[model samples]
Target: MSLRALLVLVLLPLSGCVPRIEVAAPKEPITINMNVKIEHEIHIKVDKDVEALLKNQSGLF
Candidate 1:
C-alpha cells in the first residue's frame, strides 16, 4: 500500500466526532423578592377555673 492511502484511512474516521456548539445569554434581568411575614396568636378561656372544679368531686369521671 502507498503512504498516502494509509494516512487518509487513519485520519478520516476522526473528523466525524467533532460537533459544532452555540450559546446565547438572556435579554432581561432576573429579580426575586421574598418578604415573608408570619404571625400566630392563641387565646383560650375556660369557665369555673381549675380550683373550683377540683374542689367538687361530683364531676369526676
Candidate 2:
C-alpha cells in the first residue's frame, strides 16, 4: 500500500478519539423532605399433624 493511504487510515481512527467540547447550563438548588411509617403484625398457627411430621422427619438424622 502507498504511504498516503496508510497515513489516511491511521489518522482516521485518531480523529475519532478527539475529545468533544461540552457546555453545561446553570441550575437552581432544591430541597426535599419525606416521612414514611410501616407496621407489621404476623401470627402463625401450626396443626398437630404437621407438627408431628416435622418432628419425625429422618432427614434431620
Candidate 3:
C-alpha cells in the first residue's frame, strides 16, 4: 500500500475526536449577601473643674 494512503487511513479515525468547547452561565441567579454590623463608642475623661468650666463656657470649643 502507498505511504500516503496508509497515513490517511490512520488519521481518518482521529478526525472524529475533534474537540468541542461550550460556554454557559449558571442556571440559577447569583446572589451575594453581606450581613455586617458596625458598632463604635467614645469615652472622654476630665477633672470636675474642667467639666464645670466647659458647661459654663458653651462656646469654648
Top-TM-score structure, candidate number? 3
**Which 10 successive residues of model 1 have the least lDDT summed?**
44-53
Candidate lDDT (C-alpha), each: 0.83, 0.85, 0.97
Model 3 alpha-carbon miss at residue 9, Å: 0.9
TM, every model: 0.37, 0.39, 0.54
Sorting all predicted structures by TM-score, with the top scorer first, yields 3, 2, 1
> Over the stretch 1-61, how does candidate 2's per-residue lDDT look in tens digits?
9999999998998998889998976597665666768899999779998778878995765
| Candidate 3 lDDT (Cα, 0 to 1) | 0.97
For candidate 2, the per-residue lDDT at 60 reads: 60
Superposing all C-alpha atoms, what RMSD in Å does each candidate have to the true structure?
A: 9.4, 12.5, 4.3
User: Model 3, 25: alpha-carbon shift in Å?
Assistant: 1.7
TM-score for model 2?
0.39
Winning model by lDDT: 3
Which has the better TM-score: candidate 2, or candidate 3? 3
The C-alpha stretches of model 2 lying farther than 4 A from their native spots are 29-61
Give the C-alpha miss distance for residue 58 in model 3, angstroms. 6.9
